[model samples]
Target: MPSTPLFSTYRQGENRVTSSMLAVFERVGLSVTETILARASGESTLETVVFTNQHSTGKGTVPDARIAADFTYLFEVKTARNAIQDPEQLTGHLQLLDEESGKKTSKRFLFVLTPDPVRPQIVEDLADMRVVWFNFAALHDAITEVLGDALSAPSERDRFLLRELQALFEAEGLISHDDVVVVAAGIAHAEYLENSAYICQPDRFFRPGLTHLGFYAGGAIQPQIARIHTLESRVLFTYAEADLRKTQGRNKARIGEVIRWALDTEVREEGEEYMVFLLSGPEDADTVRLSAPLVNDKVASSGRPWAWTMSQGYTSLVALTRPGVSRTSDLKQA
Candidate 1:
């Protein structure tokens, strides 16, 4: 991937893609392998015996390259979106290692690291190869070398088990707000965004209207009938790149939500649109109102303010406003 100066997804000066994220993936792989090998075989010392550009390590096994068998047990690592559903991909990599790794070692293992839990497909695939799949557990586990803290491990309620996370990453600056955003955004943009689940997160409260339905959720339910807290947590966001957009209000909370969801500067993919309602930004604060683009077309179906993209030649409706209303470009799917 080359750099595009016009594209905001990739920074102008930096590489087209962020290698730090790739490094994090590699780090996770190394940590998981170390932890698993340590726990299963009582082997702790590990090294990168193979390296490559496309493939992690080629199928060459150890001719002059294979590590000492007594010390190094060949680990076939497969990092996927989720191990459960995408088992064949995991098995495919293991099959390559099994035939290629010439030490002809027994007790060979296949490890699958997934963004989410391993699916049934992964479990079934591992059973056939006599290889076991250790999923989120390995990533969540403390390797005692890399992290030295247990930040990856889940907390029992409100408490985070940092002591254990320290043992795993061992690297400084491993976790932060930017880290979470990068990770989450990466997952959303990768192999799964095309899937429907990433586009919408509609709870009982949110009810998006189909084009024909005109926008109504039958009727609102009473709180007494059902009270669901943290509805945002339940949403599995899956949006089409084209349909994805963001709207921010003058209120910080509203803008924060929009920025969090719509910020295109991320690892996964860039968002479609981000509209902010600025109340005060070295400008007027009293009668701040929606300003439509001067060049408007009444013939357009949206009947909204439209701006033409010179690059694409697509006239995008920038915003829509009525007499005294500011129509937000917010996600109707909530």
Candidate 2:
């Protein structure tokens, strides 16, 4: 059966998957297990924080990748300066995910890759894996309709993104994104095609998934925060490890500075209303590792210092993402 086309990427980090937005999930302070990356990131779930800088998030459950959520679809996100030359990459991603997850939880996994002109083998491999596939060109017209016709120049956030995309393209000597691609494995539904069939996209793409199973209730996560940008919706920075570090370094300190400042200033001050402080690491050890220092810093800054430690192995991470510094209830409710 031919699938209907769906999804449109306007820019690097700007795509909306749902219609009924109770509030922007981007603004809310999202936590996986207990760590607080989002809150530390200025305002919780601020698109500005993620888009402007390379901010890492930890999901309540996921392996290998730190900032991923436990969802129905599992896929690798392959990004390059040149468009994908092979679909076999997805197979490797599957193996990595297998190691990270330790258990094959989903029946499907996918790869929502980028850099235009998709290689045909990418789709051919999908046939081999029984994984449905989608490519960059399919989305080109829709994406262009949203991003290309704009009279104004791209935003500072987007300009940086365009440059990054260009860099990725050039890294492989690709001349243009017109040749980029996004492939999906494990998805019988189309990522940009039929919403009913596909649940998630490569870019950590998500809409409110009430009908979708196994994904977190992101909308219910935080109510106080306001979205400055979208969630992992259409972020430009979506790769893992070195990719994350590279992107962070590009705007790391700047973004970190803001997050640090916010935790010290705002959340730390939100005082004793049973407000949660989330944190997490890869292993019970990693969680302990990041949490110990982070939690201690909050106490010490609050004039009540303490000590701590951590372990190893990081499949995924999540914490309430609280601010490091803390203080007495000097402020009142809003």
lDDT of each: 0.30, 0.28
How does candidate 2 score on lDDT?
0.28
On lDDT, the leading prediction is 1
TM-score against truth, every candidate: 0.27, 0.22
lDDT (Cα, 0-100) at 219 in candidate 2: 14
Work out how many backbone clashes candidate 1 has.
30
Candidate 2 TM-score versus the reference: 0.22
- Per-residue lDDT tens digits for candidate 2, residues 1-334, read 2132222232432121110010111222122101121121122221221122344345554343333344223433333423456656766665655665554443334435343232334555466452434332222222233235355334455444334433433444332222101112232211111211111223432223111111111111111111111122222221232134344653343323323333444422221111111111122221122222111221456677432212101111111122331211211100
The best candidate by TM-score is 1
Worst 10 residues of 2 by lDDT: 309-318
Report the lDDT tens digits of candidate 1 across residue range 1-334: 3232221234421221123223333334544444534553333434334343344245764343333232223333333232245556656766766676646544445544332222334465466544444433334342333244364342242122233333222232121101000011223322122221122232322222100000111121000101111113232222442233233222334334434454343422343333222122212221122343122222236776442221111111111112332222221111
Off by over 4 Å in 1: 1-33, 36-67, 70-87, 144-334
